[model samples]
Target: MSQLQVSASPHIHNGSSTPTIMRDVVIALVPAIIASGIIFGPRALLLIAVTVAACVISEYLSRKILKRSNSIRDLTAVITGILLALNLPVSLPLWMAALGGVIAIVIVKQFFGGIGQNFVNPAIAARIILLMSFASQMSDWVVPFEYSQRIDVTTTATYLSGAESSLPSLIDMFLGVRSGSLGETCGLALLLGGAYLIFRKVISPLIPTVFIGTVALLSFLLGGNPLYHVLAGGLLLGAIFMATDYTTSPVTRNGKIIFAVGCGVITVAIRFFAALPEGVSYAILLMNILVPLIENLTIPKTFGREVKQREN
Candidate 1:
């Protein structure tokens, strides 16, 4: 007689793997990458190309020097490169952008034992490093298609250009016709990319939906425009991409909700009360540091298990 095999209940397994999900993420990022290039001109494209090449090359050399298995094929380095580029200004020096890529893929990402083992979001970590290293360069943004004999330092394009005004036009913001980060300006493009991710089932809506909804609701209550809130800065990018990092974010549904809500609260607080204009990066980075605690606090109840009360 043959013994029946017992499984851990997920019994259903598929051909889906880490590489598959990373590919889907890359596809989702294409629309925004192209939009940024079209809007910001060659500089944007140049930054993307340079950052990506730097990341891939850095990863290759780092692995070779360390005698580790080749990791550039996993596409994590590509995603990190793209994301880091999106977080940067078009006016940054190519060398600095390349440095950001090195920090992203090598220091923050690989030094800690590659993708899934990293404690923080690599792009955000690299961004923070760059921001701290070169504050002026990081803040310098140029208008879309602004190529001239003499470069100007004027702030020509910014979503928060007129904070004194009651509100900015939501339509303009959503249509990617505003001034901001290269890829973050186009709310519509980000949403389309996010929708693609959702359709591909690479990410759970629990995090993005709950996170964005919390920000929207709070901003509305604070007399801010809800749609504009969704369209501004890196909100969409953070909600859809950064907050959903498999290594740094929560795994279970409840943990995801809490982590996202925490992101929303911190983001709103920073936007409204803090000195910085936008808070998505800091918020996600902060929450990335909290994933373990969130997981411990919100683990799913097993079948026929009693709920444990919080000890206060």
Candidate 2:
């Protein structure tokens, strides 16, 4: 008789690894990176490089100090770095950008146990921390080259910042000739990146579709320009990338919908009623905290388990 051998769960392997998945994510983000470099100039690339270096170094040092296995090889630190940089202004001080990267890797990621163990997305957490700590600096938006010809100003308010008098046309917004963060300005690049991720199967479209759909529907119902809302600020970037982080988002289909709808509602509320003009980061952070609850409620019952009926 053959010897009986039983091991741990996840016996079936689909041949996907953390590094492989992260590589795909990096590939998807390349277009956005190129667009940022083109729109924001060489300084944008420099900031991204600085943040990426900072995150990589921070992860290396933190892991060494903590006596934990090195995880930078997994490429998560790189992704975190890129995402954090994209969330920042191109003119932000390099030191501040480096500090944000350190906070993301050392505090947000490693302090919590690293990688999939993190409670919230490290980039989102870092961006929020920087925004709260340096409100003025974070709010400074740079006008792209194409838009500079139309306006005589170097800096301008974001489209969602209630500067209605200077709002760009929908075509310009879609083409990324506006004032915003490094990567959030270009809706076209973000959409292309999102499509790549979806095609590569790196992420599911459920969360992004539901999240953007909810926002559009709510904006339309609330007498706001649905297209403008969809194209403005960091909505596309957040919906496509940050909000869909696997560790911070729900796993079940129904749970994803609930989480996305919640994000949309909170985003609209903050944008329309609260003082904050941009709410994507906050919306995602709030929903990340509720992922555990969402998963608990949505997980399916075990196969072959007997159903229990409640007593009348």
Candidate 3:
């Protein structure tokens, strides 16, 4: 038999490690983090701190127990913490957020084979788990400080629906006004973060661009303004943060477009027809399960194979 060379892929490394990418994600999330803290008060920082600390600790302990070489230096735990914090309501108790972090890092992430091997997006899974476990606490939303000092908080469904009577101004919505989860409130910040990710080459534009466009087009056709749909709820957050998860998302360009479109369609369907107000999280999670199928269908054509076909 003729000798053939076979080895691992990704032969080219940009001098970037898993931890570097994770760290970039953390840096990208900062604008939103600061905006959230300003809008939601000091508790936002406290919640973020606890969640990050808990995730790191849980990851360390899990790796220790499993006797695996510790990879906590990868900053994945920090990313998970920030992501979990972004999905949480501003009023959630500190302990609950920490619990979510633990589930995200220890259970969903490490237990499933660490960063690249996890079957689902850990932060989204943790968010869903928290919602299931603490429905009331998870649904709590406080009005922005602009409204009052009393923090007249209310428990409502997620933000995809019009459950909240007082809609934030378009300007405020773009500026991270209104009230909801920490990173979720600021559409502008998410955009900035998304742009940063794009600039850093951490994520491709296909997923987020397609995801956002699908939702915008669909919503516009159904009588909603495109800009309004884009600015509302966690569309920005989920499209950029949750949908573009490296491990769970498609690797092929065509597959990414399909994944993004599927996310937008599911999100709109859930928002328009379903009882649940927010669908981005669920939509992304649903698409996460379809990545393999999408990649299979959208596999890139071999360059020389087409030449052979033409000759034939």
**lDDT of model 3 at residue 301?**
76
Sorted on TM-score, best first, the list reads 2, 1, 3
What lDDT is obtained when candidate 3 is compared to the true structure? 0.84
Colliding residue pairs in candidate 3: none
lDDT per model, in order?
Answer: 0.84, 0.88, 0.84
Runs in model 2 deviating more than 4 A are: 1-8, 146-158, 161-165, 306-312
C-alpha lDDT of residue 1 in model 2: 100
- lDDT rank order: 2, 1, 3
How well is each residue in 145-194 modelled by candidate 3, as lDDT tens digits? Answer: 65234354443333445433555567877887776788888887888999
Which of candidates 2 and 3 reaches a greater lDDT? 2
lDDT score, candidate 1, position 165:
66
Model 1 earns a TM-score of 0.91
Please give each candidate's TM-score.
0.91, 0.92, 0.90
Q: Tens digits of per-residue lDDT for model 2 on 1-312? A: 999999998989988999999999899999889999998888889999999999999999999999999888999999999999999988789999999999999999899999888989999999999988988787766668642332333222246554456688988889887777899989999999999999989899999999999989998888788888899878999999999998999999999999999999999888877777588899999999999999999998789988899999
Residue 196 CA displacement from its true place in model 2, Å: 0.9
On lDDT, who's better, 1 or 2? 2
lDDT of 1 by residue, 192-311 (tens): 999999998899889999999998898888877667777888899989988999999989888999999999999888776677767889999999999999999988768988889999
Candidate 3: where is the Cα deviation over 4 Å? 1-11, 146-166, 305-312
Q: Clashing residue pairs, candidate 2? A: none
